[model samples]
Target chain A: MLKKGGFVLSAGLVVLLMVALIYQIKNKYYLDILFMTFFWASLAAAWNISGGYAGQFSLGHAAYVGIGAYSTALLYINFHVSPWIGMVVGGLFSALLALFIGVITVKVRGPFYTLITIAVAELLYISAIQLKELTHGSEGVSLPFKPGWVNMTFRERETYVVLALLFVALIYFITKTMERRRIGYYLIAIRENEDAARALGVPVKEMKLLATVLSAFLTAVGGAIYAMYIMFIEPDSVLSFAFSIQPALMSIIGGLGTSLGPLIGSFVLSPLDMFLRESFSHINGLNLLIYGFLLVLFVLFWPEGLWPNAVRVYRKWRSGGVETKS
Target chain B: MLLQLTVSGILLGGIYALIAVGLTLIFGVMRIVNFTHGDLVMLGMYLTYLLYKGFGLDPYISLFIVPLALFLIGVLIQKLVVQRVVGRPHEVQIFATVGLSMMLSNAVLAYFKGDYRSVQTTYSTDTIQIGPVFLGVPQIVAFGISAVITLVLFLFLKFTYTGKAIRATTQNRISATLMGIDVRRVYTMTFAIGSALAGIAAVLLMPLYPTYPSIGEAYLLIAFVVVVLGGLGSIPGALVGALIIGVVETVSAYYLGSGWKQAAYFVIFILVLIMRPQGLFGQRGAEQL
Candidate 1:
């Protein structure tokens, strides 16, 4: 119980720090970066529920993002529906899509499921490009700003940052709740051994489907918010392989299956990504190379992720300098 | 037209079979999918291009040099990197290869600047007159070379002592170790041969398709689809699976719009995966997560 309290206290401190930094950073550019980081953190947390916690290892999460972005964008463009309503619709649609994909792929485990997810995302990407009439193809779509609460837009970056922080907090709470529940135990069980879980009378398929649907729904909400933030959406930008890779990278690099993993990962890696992109834009593909190299390095040297290492250190410090197992 | 589509599809299928066979070989022998298989092919193409452009060598002749080079690279990478994580978690293996792939591709991009480079062979423009269709000589040569290589590989696997050891390792690693076969040597050899085959395929197909750093992505996707459809650890199944995909892609591209060609193949791929998880010619008990 004290451990749990400590965890909550640390989380609260981090949130307070984020709020302080938002006000401290006067530059709009830095605020933009913070907002983007929080946004990605929220999505990465969503990805962690299915990928990190449930061990699904989905490689096509961009499909959900694209579906949410496009669905919301289309409704807003054609019917003039407020983004608030469209966001829910988009999330529901993505959830349904996830349900469909999960039903088909839940029987197969491991890399097979990962590959199918990639294929599904690729198919959606291609369709988005080919179906020019609806999607505008490669040209993409831009959202009209209503400059009000209904549109979820404000003139200042601070507002966006606050909203993103709220979203991240909500997602973190949900994940924490799930982690303490029976579903979390079942997910971890299935992750470790599917056959064993099934033999033990776990509803493996249903649990997996539920996890996937939740993942997709939350990811879609993130996408909806992203669309509102960017005020633009495109197939290539929204559904690219890189977008899919980011969540996985964040979850893995932070600490898979842990509540704080995705958040920590995004907090660290998003800044690196932004820095690399800005610095290496002239170097063609160097950014991706660096990203991949970092992933490899993390896998080799720190597979449990940065958060685990931090936790270990924290435990050691709290125990009055007791030597810990490596 | 249908006949023409069928013939073209068959020819393209032969190339797909050759590409996928290497992937299957690596997976079959070591249970490791060399995700960089396509990048090795890209390296092969670049090597061939340089040999032809600088040394005035024919692509056929450069094939010898490229495969040998890629074999060395494969051997070195396997010994240095892959060996370190032989029995580690799947994520480690995946990241290692994915890292190698990214590094190689980006290095190529930095060097080659994303230019579409192709070998300009004298016979590149030549074509054979088929019934209501034209078959390019380069493609015909690629198909013939693929067939010959496949046959040689099959023969080698069937007859040689080392080949039998590889097959043994593929079937049961512990049993092969028990039988006194060195599994490490088999892994190194498997990676080398697989990479060498990719090199050969690259040289064979260079005249027909443009080469670039990003070109590997196209082949990687196709190889992955074929490997899965072929069943991960089955060489013959890879060939048959490749043929199916190749034929499907060809016919679809010919009949439908080019944009929808990939979609059609992907649809078929998904359908096959759902309907028949075990690919054609794959053993019943070989399916793994």
Candidate 2:
């Protein structure tokens, strides 16, 4: 984590980069790519809270995201409640719902736990589809696209990017703080060995639930922002298994449980996803095929993920360990 | 109507049982939940689709060929990918198969373009009427095939030396190794056997259902429910669990809307987890709390 002064410096540098990036974006597409990178970075960090820090491999985060997205979208479309308020309600609602699920499956661990998480996500997806009057029966809901600050919609794409960057930065600070505090230690202890941690009076259930709530709330907030940015929402589009899996995939690829991992992962992967979308538009499944191959390769060989592994290699090379060893 | 649903559920249950048995076998022996087990099932279905499409090979005939081929694939997967994640954390193991699942399904999507495909056969629409109930011919055939294969598998595990070795290894990996059993080979073999069972299931299911890449996601959920409902590692348990799920699915779909069918089983799955994580047939000590 950046120290207090380093944090300020990094913040300033990020602001500078933001200005340069905004100035450099000549068209909507590049702006979109930048918007998506920060957008994905925020979501991945939200996932890292529960999956990475708390050590619960939740493959069903789309449930919370969908809940959040739908809560804000539906309220805005139907009731005309400002999404700013809707986002908070949605985030809090998702947290409560996650708590209910946690009550049911908190004692469960391992693959069984993963299965339950998936089941819950699928349950919500089905619910979203079935509740046609509310969710529109897969027809999806869309905002009015009213260009106003209250609606969270903006005339300028740069505003979205700036908002996304702020989201990422906010979640990053929370993660960094939690990682150094008692909550983070308790979570890691529970993750490393729940039984041992419980024996040591770590309050495993409460800690796990707390981490899950925070994670789910942040993810929902991102979902709300995403809905505003995209101005459209659907069950399959938002709550699909792929949406659920992507966060897990990103955290794993970047370095599961690390503060910088998700940021680094999204910074690397979002561009690749965009590039694939650009170049492989004609191809059917090439993008996912490549992602799968890359994921499997990483799981087998580079389980430490990308960023840390790169850091290790760089440090070794700089210290001349390679030459000495050779 | 009740009889019809019961009959159909059991028939469909046979297919579910076949898939779940393979999944439970892998989980039982290796303690690695093969999330890709359903993908293997999907792959098997595609293989059948391709064979029937290209060579005019009957799916029934392909059943013999498919399982053998799938066995080889399963063995390779266990050796190359699954083995590496065996002793690792749950996250690694889950993601490893999750990645494989993504890879296999997406590869199919890329190549097949997500069009739902089905084989045309004389018996595809044929059904037999018996005492106010109708049974689809292909469904009967699938049920028959699943039962025969399951019986054969049960006998193999009961009597055959290799099958017994697999069972012993499942019971205690280190002890089985200490007793000079080739534990590694046994794991590989179990995985192969499991995959073969999934292949047989896919072949049986092809006549009744259409093939698509993401179809695995549907069956994978069923397999999970069945694996947990039936005790992990117990073949009979998987069979029993599959039948229960099949009946529950058809009944709920009949009474409730079709969209809510999955939610019904998911409720049962969660209930089972909370009330009895050991499952209906699972021994008390089988699962770690």
Candidate 3:
């Protein structure tokens, strides 16, 4: 659906980003930021499929992230499975969980559905803590730095950045394809009005479940990748409400339901997050304070999100300029 | 032992009822889930802490002031932020409230640095003997006060002109507006009343529980469970739901363990939401959800 000019602009920006990535390969800090950008972009894209496109607006997505991270770390630690395989296992596990929740909440809507999602995530979080013997509990699990391709651990930070970028690209491509497909239409229809969608032969429950499962699977994969990159897995970091909020915030700021919006949001917000965290490390909660303000500001003034707003502004400027000349 | 657990549970449930009443009132009237409801309670706790620390004010005395203070804050919040999102989409309302919740909790965290604080009243550790169950004096007093406030709220909603207007608006916003009830004013008043109720809960909890920036986070979920279990907008539902949750919590904690108590109730919450979303006292067709 992108216009020619927009497509060219985005393609050119991608090329420039690649060049920057290559040039900053040696800079660990820059590489870290780059990895985060791509990582959040992927997570937000995963959320967008269900939350944005299908209107699930789940506030408990961190459960999938935690599941993925735990699965990969646990499998690799105990059974010596490759992270590649473990990641898939995690994705399946998260998908199952999502399917169960989605089925139960299929008829539920609005705040009630959102509340159930929160309760489900909290249930998992509590379980992770209680199942201390298996999941390591709140003390968290740390992976040995056995740098190897099979382990998905690399000596160079560049590899992780590339992996993250590739992951985000895969998510974007899948989202774009879905947006052009019949399932996307069905999801949007269901989102608009479940009854109307069902009347028009759209399997609303099945579509919502499909969206939930797909979103969960993709998010879990991102979580596994994050665990491998960070070499640590913890309930507090991965399973926290912040993790759930971050993806939604990114998607909302970037433009909900749009493929490119999440990418733009992550690229902007991730760097800002790092900057805020660094600058205000001593001042606890300052970063989150700012995030809260931004969330409020955006919802109040620019509910359409950054990408759509930018597009509108650009179009307005272009038309205004033409009119002045005329 | 079971009786003791049940008594404590009932007392705790009284406090939970106050919080849930506030939440349910806002939800029932505005059709908006005030996610920041817990944070308002947290703010109340801090206000109590400050009053106790600075002015040597008893928590009971601050109870009167704190709720009034929070009611004003609620008025400001409803007017400045919530007003714009009124009648908007559910997602918009959700984000606005969630965002405000984040801000309030974090601002408190930033200012307070996550230290847990509590009021050291004379009766903080005092307990009363009643039929083989020794209950904390604070718990009994808090329960008594909360029950009274909830009753007052019920009667007010039933009799007072503004309260009836609030009820009318909750039942049918369009009709209330058509009748010149100033639906927006009812919304502001309802939100403020909810905030005041949260303030009351916070004051009552201060003697028993420590105050922290994230203290509200735990109560936030419990409040949701209570509000949902009791039925979304029913005050009586909140009271009954809170008591059920409280009993379940204590009984499970005794049998299963402390960690699993929360899990037990959460499981119940999920089942109830799935099986009976309208809850026990809520009208079947009251909520579209």
Candidate 4:
């Protein structure tokens, strides 16, 4: 599926679909869902950097997102800076924070490390709430929307979708590039067996830190974009546990470590999320209940996620093959 | 002033200890950190709350029924979901329980519509006379019940055959299986007992605190921290960790703001993770095991 020709073909198909979606979307509801799907796919692709490909699970991506959202919002609110620039500044800030945390926590692996990531993010969340002078406290910061390219805010909805699509495509391109290189091989080796990778003289800590920094930077960019689109940034909204989990969920669902796993995951889950919001608004938790059930079923039945399986089936049909097990 | 803080902290610690003991036990035996533990506590709250609301059963009287009901639910969850994920990778195990956490909490949200519900008894505001620190009757009762349950659990693990088998399994699953222990049965019982304790915590807390679908998160986070600080599988360690957290929370709330109390403990948690990931009493490689 990731062969150069195949990737090009698929990318063409997706671009065509995006083109159709932009003008054809009459329902604002479906447009919003599509926009979110692209946005979360981008965010999840960022998470896939450390989590999916590198096999370093961080439950603290929310920390970076929160930092990004808050940094851009605060800067724009106080200095009248354009968010187009604030996003870069926010990305840099997130990189520094990630470096400090990665330095301390890169050694720990597995669930213990997952716990540490959670703690760090929760600490950031609390700090955001308590440090009102800088963060504007729990009330958060709302951007005064002035629709223009300079502000990164747009008057048209489709423009935002186009921007989000570009972000996802950029992240996907980087992921594919990394996957075909020595760096990707090193990360895969480290994930498969850290001791073996170390014996082979891989700079395990450095690679892990690099992956974490890149992941945090991209996620922060996504955060900055989201804040501008919504014109509001709050700790609970951006720094939520659910925020951290969503990307991980999407990546895992579509197929962790695969180039297009997060995009597929987002495509599947985002519509459901939108449907539940629109139709089951009164049902409160039914959407999440189904989501949780699906997650359980996926982990149990197809831990490799739906992407690989879909590829295998498509290949089988294309080859006109007999019924045979992989 | 110090004495008052200490007394209150200890009382709060007792409540936290109840939540942590069950969590530690599950981790000890199954090697799976039950992320849905807080949800179980929340479910127990709704169960008792429903009884009080629908049937007019008093919160104090429904405690008995609530634990038993929760025990059955625990057994069902163990047999159905958790058993499948045992001996799996951390990713699978973590996500499974986290999935369960999302489901259970959201299920409650769907049913209850995210409203906070409280059950107040006839003596809801009644307080017992303590020399320096003012103690409410419900808190005193919760603390007393927690103490009793902890003692009983300690004795059970020490003297009972089933408990001994559980300890053996926790120490070494293969050896326990070799020694003719029904390791799976022991796992189910441990899960049930742990869940039942969460139910007790729910019932005990109902009189003092309001029940919301998300209320369990704060308690759950405290449980995770306490479990780690106390040593992953040590009951006595959980007790000690809870006391430390409780004191830290009360002290920080006094010095800092109440809003930052949980944050204060989270800092301590990170420090502990960096300085002593094995916790105060955990063995080396305990986390890996």
Taking the candidates one at a time, how many backbone clashes does each contain? 0, 1, 0, 0
Interface RMSD of each: 1.7, 1.5, 1.1, 1.3
Which runs in model 4 stand beyond 4 Å of their true positions?
A1-21, A24-26, A318-326
Q: Candidates ranked by TM-score, best first?
A: 2, 3, 4, 1
Off by over 4 Å in 1: A1-17, A320-326
Ranking by lDDT: 3, 2, 4, 1
- Candidate 1 vs. truth: CA RMSD? 2.2
Candidate 1 lDDT over residue span A1-326, tens digit each: 45777877887888888788787878987888788899889989999999987888887899999988898899999998888899899999999989989988855766667778888998999999999999999999998877888877788778889889988998998899898889999999988888899999998889889999999999998888888889989998899887787888888889988989999999998888788778777777776787677777888788898899898999899889996875
Please report how far candidate 2 places residue A270 from its true position, in Å.
0.8
The window of 10 residues in a row where model 2 chain A has the poorest summed lDDT is A317-326
lDDT of 2 by residue, A180-221 (tens): 799999998988898999999999999999988899999999
- lDDT (Cα, tens digit) per residue for candidate 3, span B159-227: 999999999998898999999998889999999999999999999999898999977778888999998
Superposed model 2: Cα runs more than 4 Å off: A318-326, B285-289
By summed lDDT, the worst window of 10 consecutive residues in model 2 chain B runs over B280-289
* Model 4 iRMS: 1.3
lDDT of 4: 0.87
Candidate 4 backbone collisions, by pair: none
Cα TM-score per model? 0.95, 0.97, 0.96, 0.96
Please write out the lDDT profile of model 4 over residues A1-326, one tens digit for every residue: 37888886788688878777687777777678878988899999999999987788888899999888988998898998988889989999999988988877754667777877888898899999889899988897888978888888888888888888888988998898899899999998888888899999998998998998999999999999889878888889999987788898898899988888999999999888988888888898787888888888888778889898888887788779754465
